[model samples]
Target: MNTVRSFGFLAKKILLLSLITCWGISGHAQEQRPNILFVISDDQSFPHASAYGSEFVDTPAFDRVAGEGILFMNGFVASPGCSPSRAAILTGRYPWQNEAAGTHASSFSEKYTVLPDLLEEAGYTVGYTGKGWGPGDWEAGGRERNPAGPAFQDEELTPPHDYIRDTDYAGNFRVFLEQRPQESPFYFWLGTSEPHRAYEEGIGRAAGKKLEDVEVPDYLPDTPEVRGDLLDYAVEIEWFDRHLGEALALLKERGELENTMIIVTSDNGMPFPRAKANLYEDGIHVPLAIRWGEHVAGGRVVEDLVSLIDIMPTVLEAAGVEHRGEYVMTGKSLMNILTSSEEGIVDPSRLAVYSGRERHSSSRWNHLGYPQRSLRTHQYLYIRNFAPQRWPAGSPRRIEDGQLTPMHSGYHDIDAAPALEVMTEQADDPYFNRYLHLAVGRRPAEELYNIKKDPACINNLALDPEYEELTQSFRERLRGVLNKTGDPRVAGDGDVWESYPRLRGPMREFPAPEWVLPVKED
Candidate 1:
């Protein structure tokens, strides 16, 4: 009887030990799941961040992220405009893949899945502050919240400029963290609506920024007006960076810094003429910095091309989630690139990056877009203008309420600003005519530029005899990828992009340009 009692005690001890070991393993798995923080700024371009040695903007927070992890030199967005760019990032697909969401001021379809939605399904508490997936409506798609996530934008503060919004982005992030379940990880999108448009006149100069300090791009005139506008742009960008610093501090204080993956980037390029709405280097290229604490090595600069669409797959992979949907993603995960210790061209397969633009604003005939697509290689940029006859910057004049506006008055594609006004006023001057032409001129069907030699894209090489073979090769490659990815523009159903409903914003009428007036049935 004594030996039997001893055996029973031994059996109970073994069972208890086994249960504790399983619990430990489960906790270890939880620890491996890192929280994600995606920070995006509106209307910002690449080479503007301090890490890239730009003298214009001071982005210490972005630099901090780069110092701790990696700075991507060739980060490109799917679209040069805001709405489609955000849609592409959220859905992990190109803008053309999303129905109406592919254009500006349209609706997002319910068919495609977004990053936050997928992360939520995998047990993450998701939320967003400031700008998210918009300039478009998400409710029309039967979505419960913005595609970025739920809102956390209650807090506000007085802003330095009337153009700048007052949403307390960092404070809202803290609220999100506080309200989340202790055991569940969180995914937050801190999108800032800074550096867009309607900036306070002379704000940059008022802030003591020297006009000489502003480095004017070759496409714009180097006058005090343009320089002052650039300075004001810098002020707003810094405001976005300030909030980023606060958020980083909050995460560090909560002891969640090392366990979180932080990604910093922008929707597109700066809100300047010939930059924001075009497919040039300044329009599609954007700053990207990532930090994952001990998970990634610090102070690495990668030159490989990466697109914004990759964000969705990278986050999904990090959380061990699989995208098993019918709407396939064309982007590959950056996990391999992120984890690698190599600096330049970590992935040779990333030979090039692509970007495009559809209807950016209501600035065309029947709301028609200046449809353009581009392919950027290590040394060259190739552009294809589907409708070359349409005014690239909208018709030079518009008819409103049965009245015709004057010539050189309705280049609505360029955002209304002091710099734009200055350029228009000086358009006839031989000295400034070239700058005007670069901004509002009608483009050729095909344009090729050696990006290294002409970053501004002022010189076209498509018709040059020396670059004929290279131009043909790029054109073929671009078309092949577009076909493989099921892009409608290449699939003989390109008109469907125009068929998408513009659910919001005011519509305007445009008079046909001289090139198309002769063909008009009128």
Candidate 2:
């Protein structure tokens, strides 16, 4: 129960989450409260940054943030997948409550409270650049806050669809700042698109990156191709960091850094197998750093377990604003933690931190996913695969044009590793070889791992007799929360999604499963 804070016995688990988990929110807001620079990167992993001790790619800007403020070593996203993770960060509610935003293709419900909108209400100007609130739309929920800001009147700029030059995030951010209302405290989300995907192969090599400089995750095999791909990923990461540097430098040049609370972190785990789309540490764990001048002590590293939902409550606290009682927020400020005012975080009794994924990428048919849920704590991590019968990635079908069709094929953790690459490539037919065990393989419905012993989560302790004690406890913990969260399947169970009026879209028409697809009558 070593956590930031915890509530007493509540029904259905009371949406257990922690504030410490949300990345960013470093400095003191009072000194710098109204001016908030929230920067988020897509699909970047913790191991890529030098601040976290990555020798491969040097992220001086990211490291600078950590150096100037506080670096959270135990930060986690409520839901490891993107859409839901963003929803939790903004709304401070678990994905199940934000049902519309729960899945990849689904839209975020307008009924939820978005942080930017609240900040605007509290008299702060707000706007965003590049990859604001998506993978899906939020307009369907009947709210017109496209980026959900009453303060969002400035020009809107999104990142490039394909690679481009100076026209990326920083340029668009400049446009936002130039158009911002005069003499008002402004909140801007500088979301970067540098490191997501579709990089020109060997792009990093051309940039003078060395393969030996690459750091490989234990889950993936060490090989030249994997290292090279990692280097390519590193190049993009550096590009993103440099953008952050430029933004910080701009704030300083404009006399804003000292009074600006800068919060920077990634959306979810690295975009790799057993990482991005899964609920393992590699998926949910992220790097977090924050800075505030003369208030939040610099050079602090806290290990208290925290979750994304706590963001709203913390930011609200920092901004000297309350939740208005009309809206119930699930997060608390780590202000005390940052200031080291509290002796030690009370066993926040974070019964567990939870995450799930509904869909990813273009291949899923019938919208049937690798559907999964997981719970993480200091001792162990437990996962429940709702649809163990389905492939984690889309099935064994050959993707149309690119390597990305098989989503797991390019996972940075295990993506393109020599073992996976050669094993897949040399096979007679790509349809069977490409996806292989990475997807479409049968798996146990319940999995338990000793997170301390196996951080990568490679060992399945659920079925092992030696770990039965650990398995039972973890299973019970997950079941209690899921049932409390009103997950239908666990309670003799039904689908909570069934109670929800399922949103309709062309996404529902994903290719039908082979068994269900009719042989063409033609």
Candidate 3:
């Protein structure tokens, strides 16, 4: 009997040991998950970072991230406007897939689950600093906080430029770190409001930036005013980089830098005419650099076409969390590309990326949007403008306080800039008129550009007989994807985009077009 008792006791001890060992393994696995530090800039473009050899802008922090990890040569946003672009990033879905959130200043629907909330549920202490998920009202969508995360913008600083926001982005990040539990991992978003608009004019010159060093895009005239404006833009980008550097320093100081996956990018392209609100190359294409210490191989440049929507799935995969949302995510994960040791074109299947825009600003009669959907490959960019007759930019006239505003005073879609002012004020000059028309001109129903040769989108190849077959093929591909993804524009509900209310921004009045009856004001 004593011998039998001993055997039972030994068995029980062995079982306890096995349970303890399993617990240790589970704990270690949890600790191995990396932290996420996503940094996004406002209104900055690709190839502007010094890592890409841009002459005018100096971005040591972005360059450092690219040098230490990987630089993506082809990174595009789902939309050109801030609200929809950011919404597409937060949710792993196309801009149109997210109702209300698909357009500028509209409500972000609570139905679509976002990255931060998902991470927070998976034990990550999520929060954001600076700009997060808006120009739109998240509350109206029944969300209690910004879709990016809970706010950490209590800290403030004295900025050098008047246009730059006083929010102390790095300082707030420090506060978030202190508030997080010691054992829990974190996912923090560091958004910069710089380079958006209202830059202190000529601040770049004051900071010793020469106009000669600035390379004007082909679409814009090479003039002193335009060069100076671009330089000022560079100054703001540098400001954003400076804060990013500080954030990195904080992580290093805390010995958390290596365990953190740092992602540096922008919401959309630079806020320039023919760039920001348009569906052209410069409008949607933005810089992207990812560094995860030893996890991601350094000094690699990838040329795969990637969308900002992929960021959501990538973050979820890195965290080992499964998406449990009801809505389907349209973006594919970039884990394979990110982890692979290969350089260019890591994923051969990633051939194209899709982007679209709707109701960027109250630009047309009855506040109608210049709805456009596009398909971009390495060699070509195909765009289908739904309302080709309507002005791509805002109308030439507006009514304010029951009085008619002057012509050229309307194009509010193009953010106020010295370059735009120069083109408009000198519209009579043959040199400036061409650029002015390009900035706010009406587009065709079908537009295609050979992106490789005409990156500026100066030449439209859709009308050329030689490219007709190629254009048709691109159109079919774009339509196929839109239909598969259930895009409202292609799903017989294209008009639904116009029905959504503009939750924010001024509602300007424009005279009704000749084709439509006058809209009565409520």
Which is the leading candidate under TM-score? 3
Name the runs in model 2 displaced over 4 angstroms: 1-32, 148-167, 324-327, 341-351, 398-423, 427-440, 488-522
Tell me the tens digit of each residue's lDDT in model 1 across 431-490: 688888888988889999888989988899998999889889999999988888888898
Off by over 4 Å in 1: 1-31, 513-522
Q: Compare candidates 1 and 2 on TM-score and give the better one.
A: 1
Candidate 3 per-residue C-alpha lDDT over 1-522 given as tens digits, one digit per residue, 9 for 90 to 100: 132343244345434543443221245446587899999999998889899999999999999999989999999999999999999999989998998999999899899999987776566677889999988999899997899887887789999998999999999899888766666678999999988998999999999999999989999988999999999999999999999999999999999999999999999889999999888999999999999989899999999999999998898777777787588688999889889999999999998999999999998889999899999999999999999988898898888887878778889899999999999999889999999999898888999998899999989999899999999999999999999988999889999999888989988898878679767789
Candidate order (TM-score): 3, 1, 2
Local accuracy of candidate 2 as per-residue lDDT tens digits, 1-522: 101111122111222312222123334542345577888888776656888888778789888998888777767887766677888888876676566677664677766778887776555666676666766666676766555342222333443223522335666556556655444567788876667665656767787888887776666555677677777777777877878998988888778788778888888876555567677778888888888776677876666677777767777777876564543655556766766633224336544677766555443554455567788887788888877765665555533443325433422223333435544564455543433453334568988888788887777888899888887877888888777765555755434443333343333223345566679886
Minimal lDDT window, size 10, model 3: 1-10
The models' CA-based lDDT, in order, is 0.86, 0.65, 0.89
Off by over 4 Å in 3: 1-29, 517-522
User: Which TM-score value belongs to model 1?
Assistant: 0.93
- Taking every candidate in turn, the Cα RMSD to the unseen true structure, in Å, is 8.6, 9.5, 8.5
Clashes of each: 0, 13, 0
lDDT (C-alpha) at residue 314 in model 3: 91
Q: Give the TM-score of candidate 2.
A: 0.81
